[model samples]
Target: MVSIAQGTFRTVLLTPEGRLLDCRASSVLLPSHDGMIGILRNHAPMLCELQKGIIQVKNIPDRKNAYYLIDGGFARISLNHLTILAYEVITFEGMDREQAERTAALAKESVATKGSFVSNFDEEIDPDRAAFIVKLAHLSEIGND
Candidate 1:
């Protein structure tokens, strides 16, 4: 339960520094510019641009969602082949729970702080991702204490 139904498909996620994910999945759910798009076996081939959001994958059966923060990118699906080439991609697996909590706390604090200290900050953070991190910390699952 750790891969697709044995098909020849590839999803490539590229980050600014390097490639993040280049693997095969049973199904790939991506956050498109308009909304989310689901790709399955023999999906129609097409190319599209994506926005900042999560890319959920159902690689292993009955497994939890695999989340990734993508800044922006283009998605190309051709004849059952899918490729997600992005400029920046951050995987939840690579995230440090302690660091996430610290950053989340800092972000919450910065929201109340007024001054040039908050000059450069992301205006809107994804609530889903935030909630996931909070839940992960609460569950102490990713070595969060």
Candidate 2:
């Protein structure tokens, strides 16, 4: 694929807790409500509601791609500046990938356990939701894709 691949822009990532990262990136792949959406410099102005997935910031100078797992959020891209406002953000920076993978495995195992699904008057934990979360956790740590 031959992209004009021209230009760099600022990407600001913020959560309700605080700002996570602000840096220049050649492109950013977001976890939109529909699916992953990629933005590059000089892209059109747009806004998207996010979902459970990973945010990928690419082509950062002197660094590998940065990944963040977002629970839900809204993203805006305009005039070469991209901003992410997330309800929750779990960054992979300095994370122990092995531990994360193991934890996700345990979560999957628990979900698969026969008759292990639980519910309360206030909230119910369904097997399908548990499985989806486990999948997202696994993908967040994988970080390579």
Candidate 3:
């Protein structure tokens, strides 16, 4: 039988803009087109299309857990490395408290009043994604203050 060992692997998140994250994570949860896919060390190599949802990276050294909201793209897992290429990614990673709060508030207002979120004037608004943004903001503790 094939064996899966317990260990850490390199995880990277990228977008058309640039690379957003590179770290060692014990586990990762990806939003696949069909459903959620969990990854650990020594996983079988594969590639899959992604959907609009959150990517959770867990157990990184010297840092708390991380989360990224992706619009849609693809993911590749091979040689103990997980790389995600998304069309768009949103997170509070580098935002200051003020910016985070403002983003959180805007997301909340958009969901409550407009029933959808629009990131760009040309882009279509998605109510479901807006709701997910609110959840992401809450998880980031953006409005807990």
Q: Cα RMSD (Å) per model?
A: 6.0, 5.1, 3.1
lDDT of 3 by residue, 66-114 (tens): 9898889999999999999997688888878787777677777877886
lDDT of 1 by residue, 52-130 (tens): 7667766634445466767778999986667788864545465565665565554444444521122113334444444
Q: Is candidate 1 or candidate 2 better by TM-score?
A: 2
Superposed model 2: Cα runs more than 4 Å off: 1-5, 107-145
What TM-score does each of the candidates earn?
A: 0.63, 0.70, 0.87
TM-score of 2: 0.70
Alpha-carbon local distance difference test for all models: 0.62, 0.72, 0.84
Q: How many clashes show up per model? A: 1, 0, 0
Error of 2 at 17 (Å): 1.3
Per-residue lDDT of candidate 2, residues 22-141 (tens digit): 899998888899988999888889989998777888899887778776778899988888999996555546657775555455557668783233322123435654565465565454
